[model samples]
Target: MTATTPTPTPTPTSPSAPHHQPLLRPMDLAGLRLPNRVVMAPLTRARAARDGLVPTPMHADYYGRRASAGLIITEATWVSRQAIGFADVPGIYSAEQVTAWRRVTDTVHALGGRIVMQLWHTGAASHPDHLGGRVPAGPSPVNPRTRSFTTTGFQETVTPRAMTPAEIAATVADYRAAAHNARQAGFDGVEIAALGTFLIAQFLNPRLNHRTDAYGGDRTRRRRLLLEIVDAVAEPWDGRCVGVRLGPYLAAGDLFRPDAATLADHDELVTALNDHPVAYLHLRGPDRPTPDARPDTAALARYRHRFHGPLNANNGFDRETANAAIEAGTADAVSFATHFIANPDLVTRFALSRDLATGDPTTYYGGGARGYVDHPVSTWQDNPGQQP
Candidate 1:
């Protein structure tokens, strides 16, 4: 593969334009040069081939359209068959999947975009129907009490069987293999999807993890699994291409919401993670959907102090607020989740103060190009292939 640079369209600004709009400036994330701070957060758009769990042309078109983002983190991809949780979610365990993902990277890079593949293991969040009638694997045998949106409809999360010592080793090996596969697929970097009460998060939280083994017990022990997986990926990438994502206090609809006690553990874990020489740390700040649900300013400040790396902030941030975050030095970059879905030209729209398009929630999850790649771009289609 050839090397490419992410270049944004030059926008002319008036004399009143604020220099503090750090969201529009170019920055270096690890080793990749990002054209802007507007990151496309890893969204789970389940539209891949169900049988092979591979990306399709639709996936390429969807991501290619959003190439204007500084960094495009693809949907959480399964590392192995045991990590399978949802229908139509892509994977990296097979050669065919790798080949298909290379197409996505090729298209994105051809359009001068940087893309990263998020490695994920759903753990107990997976239902048996999606896992070939097999029980899902977890750190311990506890039910998260959540449900998964499968093709068969909403199914209650099952009590996953605790992985044995050998199985734990195998899972770590799976992560290493996935990292290698991602590199072969032409990913700029890899992000570990450790949030949302997945395998790694399940091990971190005491409510879900009830094991008395070495991989359990104390906070350090509970966090050992994640550290081990990170180290596994680090061996190949040398820690430069791996980034870990954590949701300190996220409570989205039907997603894993950490309780008060777990929040304390999350704080300690962030400090512990500082020891690792990984890439940027992505944090999903407080999701304030209602008026009463406000962002925890004090906790966010403490977290910024504790972590000593480039921080990427997420969770319902508009253009103005995201700019404030960068200007205040609270975060290095701001990531947008749903906003990118509606506005493929989100960065351009923000720069020109244009009206953003509203995306169809019905077509957000399982759909074709109707809602994914059909989002209109005003005048930012430089590449012919970027057209939907």
Candidate 2:
């Protein structure tokens, strides 16, 4: 059987009503049961402890507070030290991170919410300022044209040291270990960070990955690391425990790359991942919900061609556009980021066509519960005259 139901239409909103159960239909992946298709894309807010390695109680509360989503994906948690691209970013390679994440997973589970941790590596996108002035590493030595998200503000992106063959092998091991930690953390599963123009993305894009070695020259070689990581991480993970997010030519940060030559390589990738034990492919398209942004349509369709798993479509998808994509058979599910970040009861709001709570950028990156959990549920008090 397929991952999602054979429904003819995506969930629709009743204009006259305030709210209803969001597209609540069940789907199965691996062994985990997804009560609904709405997923929380992994958002990178530096709320972790100072070391950028530990999961604090607030992190648990932060996730637990938004337990109403169909599925919750944790922030881009690193799998190894070399993969640590940002300060205060969490990692799963450490025993302590595993222990700390356990608290978060337990809390979310207590709320009857399902969550997944995204395994990440920043690559050339990392700044020296963020990592003890250490040059970040990537598939090549090329520097990124983007800036880093610093504690106070944005800092310039710097050229990173390229990885040796030995380092690449070790990096693969780190991902395998992180998968083990994710299971120990009590998460429903883990998703590999192949999106948002991170380390893996850096390698996959020819524009950034200017190398003649087996790891770069062509799309076949570029996909080596990504494919290997998928196989490695799935080795020990249980439940419906694996997903991958791919931005393709996403224009976020310094992660932009065009799809002119990488198209066929992408097809091979999707075909390969589909044959694996993976559960879903999280994809991005043009329009980041914010204006003046261009979407990556070629990358969006790449996943659909060969991937048979549940497709969680993201990027600039409003309620209307999201449903349209689903109804049109473009994506099996849709992950809402900024909207999910602000609205704890997003599913409720979407169900009724109610006005979503305005997301505050002030507290978006790193802050306490101000914009995180302070948003009220869609009850009559907050949005009166609306059905609960």
Estimated TM-score for each candidate: 0.90, 0.88
lDDT of each: 0.83, 0.76
- Tell me the lDDT of model 2 at 212: 80
Task: Please report how far candidate 1 places residue 111 from its true position, in Å.
Answer: 1.1
**Poorly placed runs, candidate 1 (over 4 Å):** 1-20, 252-260, 289-297, 379-388
Clashes of 2: 5
- Alpha-carbon runs more than 4 Å astray in model 2: 1-22, 238-240, 253-255, 288-302
Q: Compose the digit string of candidate 1's lDDT tens values, residues 1-388.
A: 9999965544443211433368888999979999889999999889998778889999999999999899998899999998987778899999999999999999999999999989999888899998778888788888887888789877988888988999999999999999999999999989998888678888987777888998888887899999889889877777787889988686533335667767777778888877886788888887676744544445566678878888888886787767777877888998898889988888777766666788889998887878888888866444333311
Task: Identify the candidate with maximal TM-score.
Answer: 1
lDDT score, candidate 1, position 115 = 95
> Residue 93: error of model 1 in Å?
0.7
